[model samples]
Target: MKSKKVKESVTIMTQIVLPNDTNPLGNLFGGQLLAWMDLASSVASKRHSEGIVVTASVNNVSFTTPIALGSVVTLEAKITRAFNTSMEVFVDVWVEDRSGKNRTKVNTAIYIFAAVDENGKKRQVPELIPETDEEKVRFEGAMRRREMSLILAGKLKPKQATQLRALFE
Candidate 1:
């Protein structure tokens, strides 16, 4: 496993689902889960930069299971990549059984956030310190997506990365 810098200050803060956050069917609301994703993503961005982070996009949400009330809904977040002031955070929501038994993933998604200065101008984000093989794999995934996004945005001209950079830059 390749060990890289894992930001110790990276926190999963201010957000965990509790019993009172459940719905009529005793399942936690999906919107609430998504909201927690945003929080986790912002925390990851701040951890990477300690600057104001604003969400730029959310890729997709896949719900593999329902979240039961009274169960622990934990949102784990990590910065898989950084570009200029933008940081990509991969978040996963899991449910810990009431008996403290096992955990199951309920949802997964990717979030993009841009760090800004006090005047709201974009600023540079700190580099991500990947610590393990898992982190390295995640970093590669983020980089692939970033490249794909550039291609889709017409920023990365096919077969001419240098030219594309010069043009876009």
Candidate 2:
């Protein structure tokens, strides 16, 4: 499989937060934002693998700020790394003011996707190539995140998580 650059799989989605997508407080609902993020990241994963993919796990999701209704929401997702049949996607959520003047990052998340065949069996994905400095950082960090995930899932022991243990050493 040929290595794919992060830029090649980057996905950007923009949407306007409507009243129906907001909470009683007029802020964008957490679940709504999560759904949008999932969709955006799925596009990135599919672009990278060029095959069917399913969300394996959401490693992290942080809603740092409340996005008000009527705000423009933009999601950017890119493949950070690929491991055999799975790939890590990093998503950044930005909120634009009603006036469309300012944009602020309100959330970020990491999602893992597993490439699948028509039969729903896991399929191998091509490796990812980090072209920019930021991509390189995310690519390296994905390894540590993957190690910790496996450890927490009981698929790996702490002693076997060398990538995660390196953070403390």
Candidate 3:
């Protein structure tokens, strides 16, 4: 859209569980929740980059609890670190039961996204500004993981590359 820059790219997304999203166990479908998380993370990355963003990779997604049909799920996503054309966003999933007293962290992940231009080519993304200690820690952690992904994907030499690459070779 615009070549704008955001000091930070982060957002919180939430959804109230609906009957149609529930499974036979009367709990929300894990797939559905994951879908929501993906969408939210994508949007958060875009907010920082100010362009069309695509998912490059998602790392370490773990579900620690199930969401009941009547509960509300909140997904917090923020751009952690950004390279020339890629940004890593950290996401944490939380659930609030209908009772209004129990809010639990149920899922967490680090998703990588690439900002793209209208021609569908990858482009540089905006930088991130960490405002809190927690944000700083998460950003630093994401950087480490991003480096590992580059090596695992062969974008960089697993043994020698300090910067993460986008390809395995």
Candidate 4:
């Protein structure tokens, strides 16, 4: 398979927060935001894999600010790294001010997806080449995140996580 650039897998989505999408406190519901993030990340992973992809895990979702009702929310997702059959996606959520002149980052999340064939069998994905400085940093951090995820899932021993261990050493 041919390698693809990070820019090729970028996905952006925008939504207007409505009353039903928010909580009684008038802020967007966390679950609603999570759903949007999942969709955005899935699209990004599919673009990178060029095939059906299933979400394997969601990691490090940080909700820094509350999005109020009537806010214009935007989600941008990109493939940070691609492994044999899996890819890591990063999603950023931004909320625009009432005047639409300013935007603030409200949330961020990381998602892992596994490419699959028609029969639901795992399939290989193309390598990802990160060009920009931010993309390069995210690409490098993906290994450590993956290792940590594996350890948390009990699929890898703590000592076997070379990338994570390197952080302390």
Candidate 5:
């Protein structure tokens, strides 16, 4: 399969926080933001895979700032790296100013997705080519993050995590 550029799989979504989406504290609910991130990242994974994709794991989520009700929120997701059958996506959430002229990053998340076929079997995905310096940095860090995830899940032995071991050596 042909390699795909990270920009090719970028997905952006914008939403206005509503009363129904907020918690009693009058801030956007964490679950609501997670759902939006999931949807956006899934679209990016599908674009990179060129097929159906399912969320495998949410590796990390950082809620840095509270989003007020009626605030304009934007989510930007892109494939950071593609493995044999899975991809790592990074989603950055931003809250726009009242004038919509500037944006403040409020949250960030890392998600993993697996490409699947009609029968729900895992399918191969094209290699990802990172272009920008930020993309390259994310791509390089993906292996270490993947290893840590697997180790925490007991899917990989700590001794077998070469990427993680490199940190100590």
Candidate 6:
């Protein structure tokens, strides 16, 4: 498979938080933000793999700040790493204040997507080549994160996580 640059799969989506998208507290619902993030990340994964991709897992999404209604929420997603048939995508969420003309980062989420062929079987994807400093950082972090995810899911033993072991030892 041909190698792909991380920038080639970047996706950005912006949406205004409407009343229906918010909770009774006048802030955007957590689930709403998660859905938008998932959509953006999936687009990035598909662009990288050039095929259908499904969400394999979604890491924790800690909302640092509440996004008020009417705030313009922007989600930026990029492929961080590609492993076999799965790709790790990092999504950053920012809330923009129209009146202040300022943007504040609300949260960051990690989503793992599995590329599948037309028959719904997982397929190998192109390797991700990080060109930027930020991309390089995320690319290196993805391996450790994936190891943690596998261990948590009971698919991998803690001792098998060589990258993670090196971090602690």
Best candidate (score: TM-score): 4
lDDT of each: 0.74, 0.92, 0.80, 0.92, 0.93, 0.92
State every prediction's TM-score relative to the real structure. Answer: 0.78, 0.95, 0.85, 0.96, 0.95, 0.95
lDDT of model number 2: 0.92
As for candidate 3, its clashing pairs are 153-168, 154-167, 154-168, 154-169, 155-167, 155-168
Q: How do the residues 129-151 of candidate 2 rate in per-residue lDDT, one tens digit apiece?
A: 99899999998899889988777
Question: Considering lDDT, which of the candidate structures 2 and 6 is the better prediction for this target?
Answer: 6
Instruction: List the candidate 4 regions with Cα displacement exceeding 4 Å.
Output: 166-169
Candidate 3 C-alpha RMSD relative to the actual structure: 3.9
lDDT of 5 by residue, 1-169 (tens): 9999998989999999999999999999999999999999999999999999998889889787888888899999999999999999999999986678878988889999999999999999999999999999999999989998888888888778887876544
- The alpha-carbon RMSD values of the candidates against the true structure, listed in the order shown, are 5.3, 1.6, 3.9, 1.5, 1.5, 1.5
lDDT string for model 3 (1-169, tens) is 3333233556888899999999899998878977888898899898888779999887888766778988988998877777779988778888999997999998888889898999999887656666678877876777678778876677757556555433334
Error of 1 at 7 (Å): 3.1
Better of 1 and 4 by TM-score: 4
lDDT of 1 by residue, 1-169 (tens): 2222546435564344576777788877877888888988788777677768898777767766877767777777888877777878888777787776988877778888988999999987767777789878988788667665667667666565533454445
What is the model-wide C-alpha lDDT for candidate 3? 0.80
Task: Show where candidate 2 strays beyond 4 Å.
Answer: 166-169
lDDT of 4 at 152: 84
Judged by whole-model lDDT over C-alpha atoms, candidate 6 comes out at 0.92
- Measured by TM-score, how close is model 6 to the native structure? 0.95
